[model samples]
Target: MGSINKTDLCWGDNYNLTEWYCNASNSIASKTYNCPYGCPYFAYACKKQNDVCVDSDGGKNWNVKGSITFANSTRTDHCSEISTGPVLVEYYCDDYGRIMEAYNTNCACNEGKCTDYFPICVDSDGGIDYFTGGQVTTSTSTIKDFCGNQLYNYTYESYCDDFGNANYKTYSCPNGPCSLVNGSGQCPSTTSTTGNVIYDLFKKVKIAGKVIQGIIS
Candidate 1:
């Protein structure tokens, strides 16, 4: 907003506002003037002196790289974030409690935030497909699994696929309807029915397998 000593209004970043002022002839008049600071912006620029600078997420959406955190301070200017390629926004408070913004090109705009180091490929779950709590991940090469709240009797998985793309999957316990798969409540064991008997093959330790050579040197 660029409304000075008037009741009219205008919108945009650093836009000129026309104001009705008294000239030397002492008559009501109109003259358009520009603000040296910034226009009241729903734009990135701060509009007025009392304008505040804040990050609702505390910069949580920005990627964390090279020990960098997206943050603002009450003290000196901070090279806070990036809007495009390598350009970064430096936010500062003028002596009058006015928030001003500047730009810095001398930055490593990794993942759209200023960082001391570049990003690295990462899997927060240590390459495991399924995880509890949150599946922490980072990188330009790695991605996170998409799923809703974990379902009961359901096993989730994440891993690379045959064609080399990442994959996330959910599976029901047991091949058929989920049954008590031992006590761990997971799937892996199979059950079969013989003539007049029904027995849990996995519990019997009667699985078919052959031991190979010892651990390699």
Candidate 2:
């Protein structure tokens, strides 16, 4: 028999990278998984230590809230609980991997509804604007003066474009609609207090729109 030549061949795992990939993939496929809150799109690297599951991926380690999932089965129990208060923090990442927001559950008021109450930055002609959700309902008793007299209150909604901006002036009154004097400032009409009010509001809204453009720029 002719002498066999072994000198040209690689001796280790590098001999065939394809086989190594297939073996590694199969090993990953056979294991159970408890995934993150987002979804399966996030790859999780899992291993059991001290009889509990831990993930090696960048996602912070969290307790498996429910059950486990396998690769081949049609059903999955991939849900996991991330205790953002102490164990981990939740954040929002943009499509380009930019970190847009970072917040911890510990800062929440109600403990459960944290995301619902985060502050939003807004732009307005008046100045930088900031606000929270829901109009706070006040009773006649709550709307009293320092000297025990009554106060005014009003409620309305406004709209703006993609950038945060205020479209109208906030109005409040001591009593009710009787307190409001409504009119617009379209020129050629004689100027009155009502006309001035509308004109001022329009000017302010225009300024706010400009501010929005500035911010996005």
lDDT of 2 by residue, 53-93 (tens): 22222222122122222222111122223654332233223
Please name the candidate that would achieve the greatest lDDT relative to the true structure.
1
**Model 1 over residues 1-217: C-alpha lDDT tens digits?**
5544644333334455555667899666776666554543223232455555454323322333212112133323234544545654544433433334555554565544566543243434455423221232333354443332233334434444443445444443433322222211223345532111112211221213532232111
Clashes of each: 3, 3
Report how far residue 212 has shifted in candidate 2, in Å.
20
lDDT of 1 at 29: 78
Per-candidate TM vs. native?
A: 0.25, 0.19
**Model 1 superposed RMSD (Cα):** 17.4
User: Which regions in candidate 1 have their CA more than 4 angstroms from the true location?
Assistant: 1-10, 13-16, 19-22, 25-113, 117-123, 131-134, 137-153, 157-169, 172-217
State the number of backbone clashes in model 2: 3
Least accurate 10 contiguous residues by lDDT in model 1: 193-202
